[model samples]
Target: MSFARNFIGLGGLLSLAAQAQGAYTIQDTYDATNFFDGFEFFNYPDPTLGFVQYVDAVTANATGLAGYANDGIYLGVDYETQNPAAGRASVRLVSKQSYTRGLIITDIAHMPAPVCGSWPAFWTVGPNWPHSGEIDIIEGVNLQDSTSVTLHTASGCSFSQDSWSPQDCGTPGDGSQGCGASTDNTQTFGAGFNEIGGGVYALQWTSDALRVFFFPRGSVPADIDAGNPDPSTWGNPTASFSGGNCDIDSNFANHQIIFDTTFCGVWAGRVFGDDPTCAAKATSCEEYVGNNPADFQDVYWLVNYVKVFGEDGGFKRSIAKPFNA
Candidate 1:
């Protein structure tokens, strides 16, 4: 349980003033050995009821669906199984700890490619589904080269056109499509992401707003590498979700981080008709995924580290208090 405390001073008065505003301090880190300990394998049926089998840690390790590799966490899907009955076997993990407000930074070395019938995501969700809200930080389906960030909540949440697709953060039946922001950079997702050797993804959640930023491998800031991240100095985020219409505090709470890769269920299956490339492969997402086992050979996640930070240098180490109040 060693902590890295490296604070940079900006000269006398300014440094003191900066401290008054609050600074990000490292709270918890999950890597290789510790990463598996921090998260629990999700063996239950997928919430979306996707055509996939979520295996436990024992099965994951035995089947080579999950393990440690190159000093990082490796989570992959079954590539050897041919046309199976249930579905393609995969791994889904959810953090045992939950956070209310903090900065979550994930450094990934590789991610699953945007192959047909494949859907991968690194996101967070609170207890009780739509009532507590869900944040789709990195999510895309089929052959999408760019990542799409979305926020889903109950009624009465809305956002301006700040993102690429500014939709209401409310239920679809309520006339809102949910707040969605698609990244313009191709290197931010899929095969392009792995081509650049992956990178760091930082998500800052506060009472005011939720911001997400992506820094490609070579471009990651030195401060992050030093374990002294300062989001203020990181410049504009790739996606910013904030406005007077949305009540940030009420809409989001006690969210647990999650990582999973599933074959076409709701999103990918529903939109299978739209993707020409994917549609040409098979009549449906499940059909394509069930038959073409080799297509997902490169589908996996290689994570270097996941670090959590709190504001004002206030971080609690107790597992009981996963988040700072």
Candidate 2:
């Protein structure tokens, strides 16, 4: 049930129709001044049980873990103290609003560098875990130089590979493994991403499919710069998840955007034995993260802005909801 035969290039006429209909409209804008207003800190225990202490807004700002910096919102982690009682202090933010479908654009100036024992992500998830769905937009663990874009759902969803990479979003053997694709662009993730001053990541989610595109700093589309982004002109996406095997509308709904940096969690810790460079630093991922605070100095996120646009003026303002953090 590969989607290769059904795949539609982003630059094709279908996208042109979306633009011609002027279906997209600015729905929300999150930036330094208003970012905190629209997002809440999650201080609860990590769902993945990462070795991290999710701090509150007060603790985050007081400890310099989260604040405004370089004309953008800065979310960072503790890198000075070693072996904290609970774990290394960090910040995890979730958007107050939830949406079913839209265009999400995030302009980032910097991301956590590809350091050992760190797992950072910019993602969205619906309620009830895999039953609803999860989209990993920008994610990597422990020294990964490229991003892994993935989708986690209950079952049935499958995808085909684009021309850029080999990893395909085929149906998972077990629902827990999910489906994913990897990017080969050196500057699309990790230390190289920060070295080039970061860039924009655009995610377009619709009933038909979920597509993600990445543009380095110098190559960002002019429409994006002018605040009139049109996916029709964006060409092929870095990754696309779609086909007859899945019902996107049924698997995903009311998703909230999120950003966080955790230390030695399931993904990073489980894979530590495979990376020689990291293995030499400590016997285990948790041990290294607990002992080597200095190594995580670059664990932070500098976000320029996050804009959400909805189709046909269907966007709605979300009411504040209590979240465990």
Candidate 3:
């Protein structure tokens, strides 16, 4: 279950209506004060082969690609000039500390607009990738209007759902399309999300299962803002993956929180022509994403905060650097 997708986005809403898991204490918060320091800028090539340039921390902050706006962390991309070399300039952040199981709550003010040639996500991944595991808390490609929560893992790692589940966690078709479900609520992503001033996306990962929930701005649970989160009161999750046939412990290890906006790649680019809007813009996805630079002016992330709540701070991933150099 990698980055690729069919892009249909709409699926049945199978809910379990389980109870609130439990209360959680905040262990870490990433807001303007410590956002940059808490995460490392991925200055490497796009692993998905997207049309993007992952810049370093110095360049991102100094060049205005990453900064703070109204006390919110702002991560944006270049929107000037046409078709530059090395793809569009963007930012990808990986949390310095990783966790095994925890409740992550992200309060977003705005996400990238629902525009063609853009793929954005707020997710988590184990250090070793496929063999480890990946949970897509919020993700979509092209002009998708809502969120798609999915799980990707190595072979023989599959999970069950309340109603009916997708296939195993391994790749089903040509590539990995990890079993997942969509929120189908327009207010949960893209333009609609920004119009309502964005809200909260919470990911609850426990040994028994992984669940994702979305609360629109005015509808966020009171407990969340009060520093106490009770998932049981949040109603059915937008997407839930049961640990039935999967080995949650062995398949998922210390995972780092991630947020990024990438263009035409394995997912978006592969199905470029499949999307009428994007296809009509240009013959290829790269051409439009590269030449129509102004089209991406609104491609950005406005985060109020990201709080991780867990006992023992969840499973901490050991690393040499306490902070990103």
Candidate 3's clash total is 2
Worst 10 residues of 3 by lDDT: 1-10
Q: For candidate 2, what is the lDDT? A: 0.80
Q: Clash pairs of candidate 1?
A: none
Stretches of candidate 1 exceeding 4 Å from the true structure:
1-22, 164-166, 174-177, 313-325
- Clash count, candidate 1: 0
Q: Give the C-alpha miss distance for residue 228 in model 2, angstroms.
A: 1.0
**Which lDDT tens digits does candidate 3 get at residues 1-325?**
0111111211222221223335565667788667776777887888889999988877877677787776677888888958978999999988877777878899998888867789899988875567778888888888888888878888777766662255877776322687777666998888899888889999888888788888999999998988779887889888888846788888888788899999989898998899898888899988998878888888888888898877443434343233221
Instruction: Tell me the spans in candidate 3 whose CA falls farther than 4 Å from its real position.
Output: 1-22, 172-175, 312-325
* Candidate 1 lDDT, 160-194, residue by residue in tens: 63553455678574322467877779999998888
lDDT of 2 by residue, 199-269 (tens): 99999988878899999999999998877888989998988876646788888777888999998877988
Q: Which 10-residue window of candidate 1 scores lowest in summed lDDT?
A: 8-17
Which 10 consecutive residues of model 2 have the lowest summed lDDT?
Answer: 1-10
Clash pairs, model 2 backbone: 42-325, 43-325, 44-325
* Candidate 2 C-alpha error for residue 129, in Å: 1.3
Instruction: List clash counts for every candidate, in order.
Output: 0, 3, 2
